[model samples]
Target: MIPLRQLPRLLRIAGVLARHRVDELLPASRRPRSLAWLRALMPAPGADLLVLPRGERLALALTALGPIFVKFGQILSTRRDLLPADVADALTQLQDRVAPFPAAQARAAIERAFGATIEARYASFDDAPLASASIAQVHAATLADGREVVVKVLRPDIHARIDADVALLRALAGVVERTHPSADKIRPQAIVDEIETTLVNELDLQREGANASLLRRNFAGSDDLYVPEVVWSHTSAGVLTLERVRGIPVDDLAALDAAGIDRVALAEKGVRLFYTQVFRDNFFHADAHAGNIWVDATRPADPRFIALDFGIMGSLPERDQYWLAENFLALFNQDYARIAELHVRAGWMPADARLDELEAAVRTVCEPYFTRPLSEISLAEVVVKLFEVARRHDLTLQPQLILLQKTLLNIEGVGRLLHPRIDIWATAKPVLERIWRRRSGPRAVLRTLRRRVPEWLAAAPDMPQLVHGWLSRANAGEMELRVASDDLKEIERRLRHGQRVAIWLSAGVSLAVATACVALLAPAGAPPGARWVAWLLGAAAVGAFALAARRS
Candidate 1:
């Protein structure tokens, strides 16, 4: 439950949602009349807002809420398989079309970011926005060198707004964990922490610029994709400047046709680009919605992709990358058994998970698709189905893979929109095979060894001395050899326990023997009481020895 102080914000959220009639997701007859009084207090929306579809209204409400909600909607929009079709379609607009902060405020943010006048910073700067999104807005500008660039200014008060929304979400996550029956499996807190980290990283424009720079370096000479160059002199923690780029938006089919662009080739390239980035380079653009992607149609015969918004890039650990590549290859080969084995080896499935059972499950899900048209195949859908099957066996899902999943969904979405006939498997196999060769081949081993030679050489001179000392000690009576055996630990524990019991048993026996000797050697004048005491002591010693023996 939220504190009393946060009720107003929560109430405001409810009111805004109610005003937009978002509650109509449930039947109107289901709502209590007590809520009508609160609804009556809200101003009536115009026909324009009311006439729009339910999904649009919901998207608008989230946008109005702020960047945090916008981010949530953006992530939600990617999981079309799990969402209502209309809502998923409408949510794409939230990607980079959220209501932007004012232009004048944007100017002040830019000035404050650079600590200089606009005229002094750029030879020409437009007050009008070229593009606007929840986190930032871009303006056209020209440098002193007559180079065109776009200035990205972070919206003012974004940090505070994000902080507030995150706090509210954290509170909600806490409530969910406490009340929701499936909280442990869902891991709401862990989800929120990931969201928090991503959102916080996005707030720093310098970090985004760095991401863009690294991506640019990765594809410096590549013609398949182009990343805009960052203008370091104009970039800051709150503002980013990159070379102005123009391309046909990926979704604009009419423009693409008009430019004589090859849609089929473009789609194939998109698939290849995704695979190469993920398996080959181990980095990919996680946020790949249409709004941040475009196609360079400068040459109608050839089309290249243009990527923007480097805030969220995905990378996998070397182990995952290798396994994921093999998984893809396995899928391409229709090797269900290989896929099942890989899943088990990767710890995705439980240790005791039956490989044959998993293989049968995968075959049931994928065999029909193999004979179907390539155009109808969705890589994302296949992976999702596999995940569902694995869940039946209690799969341990990795959080790091979520970003890759989202990115894969985005890639498939773009590919489907551009060319429905594009064969993702055909496009990805060669790339995966090449990556596999480079990963485990002899050349890879040589490269690894070359990198490690210096460290090995530094320790090589001590190897002979260490071995000689071991031999010398072994040759002498002082040698103590320790063998590596799994049973040694258990044996050592039992030996120590038996040693303690033996000491007690020996003491008890000795006491009894001494008592017997004293009794036998006593003078004839000894008191009857002393003899009774000796007999009692002997009985006690026998009891102690028996106790020790029983314990041992």
Candidate 2:
């Protein structure tokens, strides 16, 4: 259920869409059957969208919905393969080109962020925004020391708006999960939670600045990619300032061509850079859309990529990184068995899962892709297919893996757009091979052992003391041991049964020997008590032997 306070925001969202005649743009199948009555609730019942195309109406409605929806459009624009060309083309307006707020508002925001006049902070601050989005607008400026930088300021009251939207999303997630039959499999709430974390992180300019600084340091001296330097002194929770870079926007093919850039090489470089970030460095800029990327065509022969918008970066745990790299290598080798084994090894699939069945499933998903030439294969499509297969096999879906898949899709779109024939697998195989070789080498084994030597040395002094304590306790008949497992318990029961039977047999044999010795060595005139004792011993031996035989 929607909260009373958030209902207004939800109504505003619906109103904007209805005002733009958004329902007219949707295909019949895309609209939910339950929401068929939405048309009756629209405010502008007579609104006509004859002047705007369906795609344009969508873009307008998204813009009116607010910044978050605009960002969604921007991301959707990257997947041209999935969207209609008209809609995808229209969404480009949202990427670093969303309609800016008033110049006065921008100025007010800057002054509010720094608590001083613009001139006092920047050598020259522009009132007009360089780019604007739902959350913030950026202004290009010159620093006091003649360094060019871009100053980003958060949108006014963005926090409250985001909070309201997030609450609405949560409410919607709950409603869908509870009411929809397939919701358990989809896990809409989990997805919403992930989105909330991402959006919340993006709201903090200080965090974004830190992200920029760390990424800059990661590729500090590299020519393949460059991360702009952050101006730490001017950065704050609501404001971020970073060194401005000049380059041709990555999507501008004409500009790249005019500048003599080698598109194929640039495309290949993108693949290498992605692998390096994900596997080698284990850190990547999750949002690598064309809007956040540029090409330094000044060095056309040696093109370099310039990255911006460091609000969302991703990294995996060390184990996942290695497993993912191995998975990639296994793909290249067409090792379906290894891939199946890897799923179990990575704890993605249950240990008892039939490897042969998993292998066959993998082959079913992947074999068709190899029939096509490597240059013609789509990396994103294959990844999607594998995800479906994973779901079928009940594999444990790792959130980090999802993040990596998203990043890969973004990268693949950018790469294919730049060079249609560039083979992603061909470019990535050697890099993964190199990483695997280094990690699996004997030197790595030695290095790991060397690192543990100090730990072993520190514990060496206690070993003898531990040994002595165990021995002393054993001698005092106070030793104790405990282990828990059904298999071990059964073995323990059998061992105990065998030990009892052995004792019983030994006692019976000893008694029998004693009884015989007493009878054989006694004199003819021996007392009746001796004879009775012998008879008693013989009878006891017979009973003991019978008990031992029954047990055995």
Cα RMSD, each candidate? 18.2, 16.3
- TM-score, model 1 to reference: 0.78
TM-score of each model, in listed order: 0.78, 0.77
| Index of the highest-lDDT prediction | 1
User: lDDT by residue for model 1 over 433-473, one digit each (tens)?
Assistant: 88779878988876775565445445545644664564465
lDDT of 2 at 177: 90
Model 2 is weakest, by summed lDDT over 10 consecutive residues, at 74-83
Per-residue lDDT of 503 in model 2: 62
lDDT of each: 0.79, 0.78
Q: On residues 55-123, what C-alpha lDDT tens digit does candidate 2 reach at each position?
A: 788888787776788766655554443356577668755544557878777677778877998889899
Question: For model 1, what is the C-alpha lDDT against the true structure?
Answer: 0.79
lDDT of candidate 2?
0.78
User: How many residue pairs in model 2 have overlapping backbones?
Assistant: 1
Cα displacement (angstroms), candidate 2, residue 39, comes to 2.5
Runs in model 2 lying further than 4 Å from the true structure: 12-34, 40-64, 72-97, 446-552
